[model samples]
Every structure is written in structure tokens, then in C-alpha cells.
Target chain A: MKKILLSFFVALAGFAAHAQETTLAPDQNPRYAESRDRYIKAQDQLLVNMNTTVQQTYKAYDWYEAKQERKLQRYNDRRERRLLRAQYGNFYSPYDNNYYSPYRYAPGFRRNGWRRGW
Target chain B: MKSIFLYATAAILLVTTACSRKVTRIDPVDTPDISGKWNNTDSRLTAEELTSQILTEKWIGDYVQAKGKKPVVIVGMVTNKSHEHIEAETFMKDLERSFITSSKIGLVQSGKKREELRAEKADQQTNASVSTMKKFGLENGADFILQGSINSIVDAYKRKKTVTYQVNLELTNIETNEVVWIGEKKIAKNVKN
Candidate 1:
């Protein structure tokens, strides 16, 4: 009876060793397969989110810059015209020939040295 | 026999536990919400566009005040101090466009424009009769020079980040060195994982 019990024990040990040596396929291992799938899905979602954020951020910056550009352009245009008029006198009306022509000033104004008086 | 059974049970439990801990595939339900966070909050403009806008606002106002007189304007070099590579030329162009569109200030091009003008005048003098081509000097200098800088800061963590940008512009009297006007724009962005 003792010998029979020993033989049974050896058999059990051999069976356990054999089972340990066996390798289960990934698909067969439900826990491993599920966890790996979850990780992959998470990675894909993360990528999509990252890409969307980048595009949106770029667009936002672009819009803001464009608006500001328009504003600055308007300001500069007005400023330039003002400066031009100041330098050359208003171009809207014909130049006063008398005011501009050195030879057409008040009669005898240049001859009598009376330019300073005016 | 009892010991063998215990050893077998322990081995199976260990294998199951190890297998259960692995991540193989992701669930569709847990997919990230990319659309929710995706949005264009800030817009960008080319340098020329920006310059035009600035010029239009200040130039028109100044022109109206001067009563159709072209006021002298000196556009100074814009400085870029931001984290990204930015050209101040865009801002300058916006200022120039504003001046040109409004017909308010006499906007002078920088050294480059002046050189080009000089070369053209020289060519006219040599290739064409002096009498036919009018020789004119840039009579108006900038009465006011506009200058400014851009700056920014970024704060970030794992899969999340924040950025802040600032633009500061100033108009100053060239002769007196007095600041007449100051314009500024600030932008901020937040990103999540």
C-alpha cells in the first residue's frame, strides 16, 4: 500500500511538472490578451487626442495673429497719409500758386527785404 | 497526494494571475475624447497683414486729426523675444499697410527700401535724361517711430502643457523720445493628455 501511495505521489509530481512546461498561446491567455488590448487602445486614443490638440492650437494662434495684423495695418495707413499731407501740404485742393511761387510773393516783398515782416 | 494537489493549484493560480495582469488590447469604450479638446482658439496673421491693421487704426486716427495731412512716421525695428522663431518683419508690414491704406502717415521703408530707392534714382540719372525724371529726396522723416517685442512662457507636465504669449508694441516720438501709444496682446493655451 505504501509503495502504491509513493507511485501515486510521483505521478502527481510528474503531471504538475508537465503542466508547468506547457506554454499557452497569447489568445488562450484571456487575462494577458485583454490587458494588452487595453493598453494598445489607450495608446491609439492618446495619439488622436495629441494630434487634435496640436491642430487646434495652431489655428488659434493663426487667427489671433491675423486679427492683430489687420488692426496694425489700418493704424499705419492712416498715420502715413497724415504725415504726407503735413509734409507737402493738403493735396485735396490745388496748390495756391501765389503761396508756393517764390517769385509771386507780395510785390516788392523780396526786393525791399520785407520778406521777414510777413 | 495532498501536497501534489496543493502544488498544482498554486502553479495554476500563478499563471492565471500573471496572464491577467498583461494589457493586450484597449476597449473601444475607453477611447480618448480627442474632439472635445480640439479647437482653434488663437489665429495667426502674416507680417504684412498685421502691419496693415496697426497702420489702419493709428494712421487713420492721426490722419483725421491732421486734417488730410500726411504725418511723418518712423517705423522702428521690431524685436522678437519669444520662444519660437518669429520675424518682426510681419509686424512692421502690418504697420506699413495701415499707414498706406489710411493715407495718414508718411511711412518710410527701412534701410533696404531706402537703398533700393537710391539705386533706382541713380539708374534714372544715368539711363534717362535728368530733365525727364524728377529727382526727389525722401522729404519726410518719421515723426513717430513704432517698436515692440514678443515674449512667451510654457508650463508642462506628463501629457499636459500650457503656453502663454505676449506681444507689446509702442509708438514713440523720435525727437523727444516720449512714448505716445502702447499696444499689447496676450495669448494662452492649455493642452491635456
Candidate 2:
């Protein structure tokens, strides 16, 4: 009985050694698998941080750009109108009621004399 | 009297047409900067110089040799903190274009565009045929991200002002957070009013 029990224990040890020689399931190596998972989680978090940073930076940038665009448009339009008025005297149109031009049809109004007034 | 009327008509016609807003097309290269603020030439030339500098750095070679592939890059935000309204997007696009044309690095979309791409993919998942639908989590992640700022300093006295714009860009490794390359381009203009 003792010899049979000893042989049975030896056989169990051999099976355990064989199992070790064979590839273990991922779950069997909890330490390595957990470390790997942690690494991946850290990496994913890093990437998420990176994306968030980029998005926030661009959000501010885009807001400023649009604001600047509107401001520039306003400035440019005003400047262009001022330039047009300077280059050519106030535009007069007969059909438009909203046309409030400084130069109305004066029978004797001289174009060159307007400069002399200044 | 007939000749006087004809001359009057001719003079009126000439006056009506000659002094109105006249637009003459000229080469953009020939277009001089009327306002000494940041302009297209500054953006284009800065991108060209920085792209060349970024590519020639040791980090690119190290990454290529270690990874056995070209580094994928995504251009992030370039904040414009200049005295004038500088469109940093144009400069960013110029940099992206130069990177692509160089064929030395891979480029990926960032910010809203990337979100748009992901949204499209999500839509495709439900709407498209099973065989034709794109898979999720298949994006080639960027290995490096380039971000920067455009800053300026202005010194003015009475009618004369000197504006100096400094464009500083840095490329950082996305994985390691290592700044691989840093570049700066300075453009200055003197304006007199």
C-alpha cells in the first residue's frame, strides 16, 4: 500500500511538471497579465490625455480665429468704404431713397472747388 | 454745339469709368505687404523652413531605425498669441502639406476632423453592409504630435513701429512625451504711418 501511494504521488508530480512545460493560459499568469493590462491602461490614458489637450488647444484657437475673422471683416469693410469715399466723392444715386450723399445735384457745384474748401 | 455735346459725353464716360474701384490681378508673389502684419509669405516660408528642419533631425532617423517604419505625425493646435490677428490654421496646413510632400513621414488628422472620421465610422457600422463596413479600433495612431505658438513683440514710437513675430514649434513623441525637435522662425517688419 505504501509503494502504491508513493507511485501515485510521483505520477501527480510528473503531471504537474508536464503541465508547466506546456503553454499556460493567460489567466494562469496573473502577475504578467495584470502588468500588461496596467501598461495598456496607462497607455490608453496617456493617449486620451493627449487627445483632450489637442482638442482644448484647438477649441481656444478656433474661437480666437473666428473672433479675429469677424473683427477683421468689420475693420476691412469699414476701411474699404472709407477708402472708396475718400478716393471718389460720396456716391449719388437717383433711384435709392436711402442714398444720403453729400454731393447732391447742384447746377453750379464744382468738383475741383470742393478740395479748395478744405 | 454738336461737337461740344459729344465732348461732354466723352468726358462724362471717362470720368465715370476711370476712378472707380479698379482691381488688377497680379502674382501673389509680387503682391507687396501693405500692412506689416503677418501675411501669407510669412506663413508659407515659415512652414517650408520648419518642415525641412523637423525632417532632418536625429529623432526621425532614430525612430525610423528602431520602428522600421516612418513615424506617423499629427499636427495639433498652434496658438496665435500675436499682436495682430494671425490665422494659425493656414500655417498649420502649410506645415501639413510640406510634411506630406516630403514623403519622409506619415500624417494623420487631429481635432475635429478626427472626430468626424470616427463619427463616419460609427455610422458605417450600422448602415453599411456587413462585408463593406469598416472596423473600429483600426486607426493608425500618431506616433508624434506637433504643436506650437505664434508670439509677437511690438516696439512703437509715434508713427513708426517694429513688429517681430516668433513662431515656435515643437514635435513631441506621443508615447514617451519626449520632445524630439524644436524649431523657431522669426519674421520682423517695420511699418511707418
Candidate 3:
């Protein structure tokens, strides 16, 4: 009887050790669960709205950048056409001893990575 | 007569077009985010985070248990180490307003304001009544100084840039020089050109 009782106690202890309890459970209260579900749905809707907004903003910004790039390209092309004379836009203005270019400083000199010609 | 009429029409057109600016008033609490830089929204959010986190920290409870009174805190320097010129003063002002009104911690005068207070008290010593004049030694010394830094990291590829700001604040005990509490608020912004 003592051996049986000791074996029963040992088996109980082993079972207790191996059978770990879990504390993860959804709220049982109806009010709490309702609020949680509402909060989750609202959060999901907010994320959807945010993603839509971010995508739109990114697209708009990209369009604006493309517009600016096109404007810059047009300006450069116009300047190139104006500069590419018979002398490859190397024509010096008679008013000053400077090339007829909008770029500051001499074409042979580089100032802040800006030069009409090198 | 024709030349005068042409000039008048041109003048009226120019004036009307020049003054065609449309102004729309917005709620200060909720405004549209433009340029995605640090603004009043960020300041308000940081202040809100600070109020909630500081009040719920273990240090507050510990201090209350030890002293039976709320700890006095003085707002100090908050350095802005960002790529953009972010004004930390606005954030500090928001925090100060929250701290004073929260009733969680006793707030004290700090920086130039404290110096000006002292100067006023000195002036009052000679000009004002004894009871009305504020005394210098009677002021509440701060138990902790709240200081922090606004640091940012920006990653740019072509026209899009992601700016991440880490605002770190620490409360240190004046006597022990031990950091009793630390709080951080991270705000990330994705800006595209």
C-alpha cells in the first residue's frame, strides 16, 4: 500500500511538471471583447487609410520630381542649343572678357562642380 | 483715350491677380502634415508620451513611497541633433506646460527664467513690501533634472528620404547623480520629393 501510494505521488509530480499551463486567453468579459474587436477593426481601417495616403503621396512626389527633372532637362537643352554655335559655344562676349554662358566663373575653371566647358 | 484705357485695364488685372491668395484657417490641434519635418504635432505627441510614461514609471512610485511627496522636477536643456533645424524649445515648452498641469510632479523654474526670478526678487527687496517680495532661499530645489536630446538619422535614395528621430530623456537624482528614470520616443517620417 505504501509503495502504491509513493508511485501515485511520483506520477502526479511528473504529470504536473510536464503539463505546463497556458495563460494566453482572450478576454472573457463581453464588454472587454467587444471593445477589443472594435479597436482592432478601427486600427485595421486606419492602417488601410494610411497605406492609401502614403501611396498617393509617394506617387505625387514622384510626379513632381519627374516634372522638375523635365524642366531642368529642357533648360539644359535650350542652353546647349544656344551655346553650340560655330565655335562650340566658345564665343566670348564683347561687353566683358567672359564666355556668353549663365554659369559663373571661367569655363576653363571649375567652381563647385559647375562649369560650362572644361 | 485708348492708351489710358489699356494702361488702366492692365493695372487692374495685375492688382487683382497679385492679391488672389486664398487663406484657409485650420485647427491647430489637427493640421495637415506638409514637408514631413518636425512640427507642432511631433512636439505634442512627445509631450503626451512623456506625461504618460513619466507618471507611470517605477521611480515615481518609489519616490512617493520614500518621501511621501511628489518629486520636484525642472526642465533642462534638450539638444536638437538633427539634419534639419528642429526647434527644441517648442517641445520643451509643451513638456513644461504638461508637467505643471499634470499634478503628478512638482515643477520648478529653470534656466534663464529662474535667473530672472532671482533678479526680480532682488529688485523687490528694495522696492516692494516684505510679505509680497519672494525670497531666494525659500524656492523649491529640484529633486531631478529632466534633460534629453533629439537625434535623427536620414536615409535618402533619389527623391525619397526616411528620417528617424530618437528623442531620449533621462531623469537623474540631484544628490545621487543616479538616473532614476529614462524615456525615449521614436518618430520616423518618410518624405518624398
Candidate 4:
């Protein structure tokens, strides 16, 4: 009976050793399922943060660009308006009788007067 | 002898415990510091910046003669060829809004405004019992159509990965298939265990 009990104990010890050898340590074990889940969560959070940052930066950029653009547009518009005014200011309608100045007629009339007196 | 064995066992246990306790310190999983001044290379506006740069170029500006006329633009499709599912619409909308707010372009809402005008005219004709209602059609077609695409490539190792994204855009004439403008942006990111 004593021999039988010793054999049984040895068998149990061998079985336990085999089990330990087959099993992996906690850290080394495949927690891929769990790690994958965590990774997905982390990725989602990162994406959200990235999107928010992008939006904010884009908004700020747009604001700055808009302000600068408005200034430039106003300046250009003013310059163009001034140019148009200068170029078209001396223009007159064809129907206007005073299209030419009266100085030329003054000289011609004087010559005609002298000829008439002669 | 029993005391010596006890001491030896304690010593072995202490050594094993110390070896097993390998201080991992979990130092907050080094995340990418997306906060600071990032280059336009890694930014979302890379494509837009490039496009704007192209637009501002003296040659393009001179050719377009768009100086006098506000840049009238129409947003078209943006195809995605990236591995990850990304919405191109969001970025396109941002660009459209930027153009509108900038006032650099006389943005005409495609069909929507014309429809509204037609409805108004129809209502007027119904009320007045007049056949002399003004017919409204495509009063304005877009001078330029903006189209683009997004593509990506990825490489990965054991808990380490790299992703690259590329965005390209083009402006084409409505009457002609000529590509009047071209723009591109690229971004790359690295992640590790």
C-alpha cells in the first residue's frame, strides 16, 4: 500500500510538471484578442483627437487666410476703381458740341476778322 | 542542517522573485505628440496648401486672368484609395467653405439657386395668370471643376506600424477636358509597441 501511494504521488507530480511546461506565462500568453480590442479603442481615440486638431488648425488657417484675402481684395478693388476713374474721366459723348476746346476757334475767327476788314 | 536548508530555500525564492518582478514601468505608452508645430507634410491641409500655392503662382495667376473675376469654383468627386476608410467629403467641404468665405471666387450653388428662382417665377406666373414668365435654365455653369483622390500604403511589424497617405486634386475646364490646375498632399505616420 505504501509503494502504491508513493507511485501515485510521483505520477501526480509528473502530471503537474507537464502541465506547467505546456502552459505559457501570463505576459507571454496570447492576449491578442484583448490587445486587439485595446488597440482598436486607442486607435479610435487617437483618430478623434487627430480630427479635432486638424479641424481647429484648419479653422485658424482659414480665418487668417480670409482676413489677409479680404485686405488684398479691398486694396485691389480700390486700385482698379481709381484706375478706371482716371482712364475714363476725360471721355465725353459724341453728341456733345463742346468736345473740343474754344481756343482753336478764337485764332481762326481773328484771321477771318482781319480779312473782312481788308 | 535543517536551518541551512531553510536559508538556502529562502535565498532561492528571493532570487526567483527578484528575477520574475522585472520592473516594466508601463511609461504611458509613448503616443505620437500631435500637439506641436507639425510640418504641412504631416498635415491634412497639405493638398490644399499645395493647390493654393499653385494657384498663387505668377504663371498660373497670369494665365487664368482670374485677378479681375472672383474665382468661381465647383466641388466635384474625391475618390478614396486608402486602406483605411476615410471620408473625403469632409475635407472637400472644408475646401469649398474656405473658397466661399475667402471671396476669391464667385461661388454659384449648382442648380439649387436656379431651382429656387424657377419656383419663384412659377409662383408669380400662377398668381398673375400671365404666359410672359421668364424662363430660367442653367444661367451659370462652373468655370472650374475641382476633383481629387486619396490613396494610402501601410507597412507593419510586430506591434509596430507605418502608414502613408497621399491626396491629389485637379481643376479642369467645364467646356474643355484641359487640366488647368493640379495639387497634391502626402502624410506619413509611425506607430510602435
Against the true structure, whose TM-score is highest? 2
Q: Pick the candidate with the highest lDDT.
A: 2
Q: Candidate 4: lDDT over CA atoms? A: 0.58
* Residue-level lDDT for A111 in candidate 3: 60
User: Candidate 3 chain A, which ten residues in sequence have the lowest lDDT sum?
Assistant: A50-59
Give candidate 4 misplaced runs (Cα > 4 Å): A1-118, B1-44, B47-51, B58-60, B63-68, B110-135
**Residue runs of model 1 more than 4 Å from their true location after superposition:** A1-118, B1-68, B134-138
Give per-model TM-scores.
0.42, 0.60, 0.60, 0.41
> In candidate 4, residue B87 scores what lDDT?
66
Error of 2 at B72 (Å): 0.5
TM-score of 2: 0.60
Number of the candidate with higher lDDT, 2 or 3: 2
Worst 10 residues of 2 chain A by lDDT: A51-60
Compute the lDDT of residue A7 as modeled in candidate 3.
100
How do all the candidates rank in terms of TM-score, highest first?
Answer: 2, 3, 1, 4
**What lDDT score goes with residue B20 in model 3?**
100
Higher-ranked by DockQ: 2 or 3: 2
All DockQ scores: 0.01, 0.05, 0.02, 0.01
Task: Give lDDT tens digits, candidate 3, residues B1-193.
Answer: 9999999999999999999999998887896789788787887788778767887879988998999999999776666666566666666667667677878788887665666788999999999998897776899888998877777877766778787888888899976789999888999989887
* Most DockQ-accurate candidate: 2
CAPRI verdict on model 3? incorrect
- How many angstroms is residue B165 displaced in model 4 relative to the true structure, after the best TM-score fit? 0.2
**Predicted complex 3: DockQ:** 0.02
* Per-residue C-alpha lDDT of model 4 across residues A1-118, encoded as one tens digit per residue: 9999999999999999989766766666465557657878796343332111121111222333456679999999888866753543322445322323232223345654222211
lDDT per model vs. reference: 0.59, 0.74, 0.72, 0.58
